[model samples]
Target chain A: MDVQAFKQRILPVQGRLFRVAQLFLRNREEAEDALQDVMLRLWSNRQQLETYQSLEALAVQMTRNLCLDKLKAHSRQKMATDGDFPEVQATTATPYQQVEAADSNELIHRLMEELPDQQRFILHLRDVEEYSFEEIEQLTGLSVNNIRVILSRARQRLRDSYTKANDYEADY
Target chain B: MKPTIEKLLEKYYDGETTLDEEKELRAYFQQENIPAHLQSHAPQFRYFANARSEHPSLKSINALANRLNAPEPNWVVRMGSWSVRLAASIGLLILGFGGGLVYNQLRPSAGKGTDLSFISETAPEKSLKQTLAFEQLAKTSASERIDAINQSYEITQADQEITQLLLNTLNFDSNVNVRLAACQALARFEREPSVRDGLIQSLKVQTDPNVQITLIDVLVTIKERRAVEEMQRLAENQEALDAVRLKAEEGVQSLNQAGNAPS
Candidate 1:
């Protein structure tokens, strides 16, 4: 495909690709690099890009694979040892409530980090990006039922972890 | 949490919720007024919504596009071959002209310069072969090619090759410094109509503000009345750099004055 065609077709989906990368790698710079690399690969293959059923799904799949290939072991190690995932602000609460809100935000990210990679990615695609089950299935090469099961398990795991953290905080 | 939301949340974590029900669960958690016990789950919904807002920079997007969509390999190979042939022919033409100029310089007393006759008598076929050899050097050293063009500039009174090189350089060289230097050299040969036209054309297409301003300055100094309209258009363009617009405005005024004055 020519550049303008590629830009119109694929460039607009970069944010989704970046977010997926961020979800997988949990580092903004690493995610940015992964997205850039994926975009370059997509561009080189643009001549055949249009034949794909969903460019967005393909891009997301590429970003996921790139980040998964290079995700740092230390990040996984850090999550287990320190429960530190990068800071993410998910609320517009007042400063009075922001401390509590931010704590939960970090907790959610950490919980996801602790989940199995497939479950984490499945939940992210469905919950965050809001891709349909069929779309997620096509991207992930999983059945719709498998996606539902993984996402359900991922949410339950998140709830269990959040409860444990809350209990620990209360004990302190 | 509301009883309905409680039911949806339960269905949500049980692998039994439909997409719509899951969205409802997400919406319920997104609110600020969820029961304190369920507040920790709010971020999971919030993360999804916030992550959607992430955007990579436009610079990275364009860089990827440029790198990946570079000219096709066959086109590059074809252009390389064409350029080599063109450069070879141009080199021979310049060498033949340079030899004639040197011969003229040595033969001030016509037919009295026997010492250098052998050098000037090199066969045209040999020069063609030498030109092919020089073409190899030209591909290796762009600086050498530029130097050859510069040497041609010295003999501009005899031919158009120098002006052609200068015009090509001004219009197409990727290096701003080379184009800037070419603009300066073109000023010396402003008597050439091609140089005058090239300056105006370059003004219209050149992206560099420095080159635009220089082209305007040269056109104004030469009083090329034809450039006034292009300069006016450039001056009025909002996207043109401030200095370039100002220089273009000045060029139009000076060209108008030069037009009104009697010879």
Candidate 2:
């Protein structure tokens, strides 16, 4: 793949790739960095790019792996510095007033952020990105049936939390 | 039609809905007059619709493309393996020695009292980290800049320079998340008069819903009464998204209530 071909083929999928990165990283800046790294890696391996059946799937997989690596590195650093300043952690905690005042959209966003990482990522790919089970399997290396099960669990979890939160709000 | 929609919702939770079925569900939820029975599900679908629009900036993409399109240096590729290894080791040695020399010079003399010496040892390290973080904020990659802001948490003391940089980021950073992080970081220095004024000013310029919401949250948390008018402006801005406007309105109400309460 020449530079022009690479741009034509890969640049268009950056939005999808970036969404995957953000789903995992939960930070736009980190996701943008991950997207750039994925693109650069794909370009360096452009000679073998055509061998893949799905370039978009390849890009998503690379993004997911890069985000996982970043998460791992972040956790490792956290562990090394554990207990150094517990008060500092408390500063970022959501103010209680905000919780009482959260709108439905904010409530749902918080619920989504609280989902398990695997479930959240699958939910994002299926519902937000609208990837098919087969496409998701290709990207995640999970079986199609496994993907369906996980996606079901994710959807159900969101529904459960959304309803529970609304019910709590209704009581007030 | 309601029965069909209910059936599709069941399939959606079971992960059996086809892409088209999911689209139909999204469209149904997007309507303003969704029945109360189905209203709870609307936010999730709305979230999905919003998430679909999340994307990186075109400027960053173009920058990455240009960087990759640039010609690679042939000399490095042409170097022999042994020569490359030798050169790398020599580079590392110089860097190590030079870093050690700088550290020694930066370290305070050891003969002082233990408490004073301890404070001096940490003082330089904090400033060094602050300097590195300030430099990182100028880099093109938003991630590098965020990392720089994260480093500011370690400095303990509220340096005027870092506060100004963060305020600048909150007002002007191209990435919403970067600006949001800056807002959160600034909350640590909420007591500073300048920081409070900067945040109140930021409420006027921020248009992104997420950042606007966060700025309001931070301002509210710090009980910045001055922010109430700015929040009222955002609340009345017709162009603002419903969520942002609602948040601003709520912020105004809360700030006003707090002001009225006898301390």
Candidate 3:
């Protein structure tokens, strides 16, 4: 984990780290924060690289854990502010009313904005990151059954929601 | 018994299936003969396995590489810092937020000492309060005094509270490019074990779809096997969002390749 080697090793994964941040925090700044924070830890803990059988796996573990911590802190901070922060608006998109301008993808994002945080969390990890049931179980502390049931329902809801949202739009 | 699609799907996420089983499952998914009831599940299942198949945005990666790769330039940095400071001061004067204010505002923060000067210049409204003493000293009314405080001493207030505060302010930055840049600059820090943990936590939970996609890309590049596992687990979770699960699957495939690569 010398400096240059570390850089080369992680350069391959930088995109991954940012993607994790983006997916979880839902904000580029937060994603970058997550990315930098993860990198800083990796740089400082160069000595501990030998502890894991796979450094890349270890890096993923580290990122997931870091994101969890950040998310918790963020929630706590948000509670402390008595809802004064404008963070909610940034994350929660207003459903666009105009049919012509609203694409299916945009409708989907809008629908996603309305789902409970927990469901969204599980869905992204399963579909986007493509972790295993056991892997998801390990990260979120949920059982494999719980993960599977949740994912099945999430897609159904998305397909339904997508259809329902654009029912009146004239199909081309 | 030889593996069937169901068995492979059962262990698909846990990494239990052999490489061959995975291929078989993918092949089954790609075929047109799946039962009608199972047809919907077909895409979802194929999606989880194929999730890792997505590519990430390279433009941002290249910029990140340039930053990480450009040697520290310490000696040059040491020598140039003095001139850079002087030149920056003159440039600030030309730009005229006052030399000190612009200088304080423009310098990249080290996340340690408070940049009161920068705060005073940038976040004056948040930094200033309507003190009775200030009211007495001023010729203005209470409302006017508040207005003056708001206008004159708008400090950005970098303090012990900065990490949280700056992290919060970072979200609403009017300039998307600056927001993106801050995100890029923060990538270096993922290397720390604690920050690494913090990042993982954030990625697991944050709700913004746009941001979620970005995180998936990072995981792919980092190739963290466990994070890949976490993502797969989420995909398997019935409660997980469709978009998020999809992103997780893509991340997993990317990491699988990176992880299982020929060394």
Q: In model 1, what is the error at residue B214, expressed in angstroms?
A: 85
DockQ of each: 0.35, 0.28, 0.05
lDDT of 3 by residue, B82-167 (tens): 89999998997777867667577766464323566554435443343222222343443445433433343223333323223222
Residue A150, model 2: lDDT of 93
lDDT of 2 by residue, B1-263 (tens): 89999999999999999999999999898666788899878889977876677668777887787777663443345566668888999999999999999878766454346567466545543443453354444655777667766766776778676688789888887778778888998999988899999999888888789998999999989999999989988989999999999999999998898889966
**Chain B TM-score, one value per candidate, order as shown:** 0.46, 0.50, 0.32
C-alpha RMSD of each candidate structure in angstroms: 34.4, 47.6, 52.2
Best by TM-score: 1
Docking class of 2: acceptable
Q: lDDT scores for all predictions?
A: 0.74, 0.80, 0.54
* Candidate 1 docking classification: acceptable
- Estimate, for each residue in A2-115, the C-alpha lDDT of model 3 and write its tens digit: 668887787677666665655556555566667767776786677787676656656766777887788887663321211221222223334451221233333444555456
Count of steric clashes across candidates, in order: 2, 0, 120
lDDT (0-100) at residue B5 of candidate 1? 76
Order the candidates by lDDT, highest first.
2, 1, 3
Between candidates 1 and 3, the DockQ winner: 1
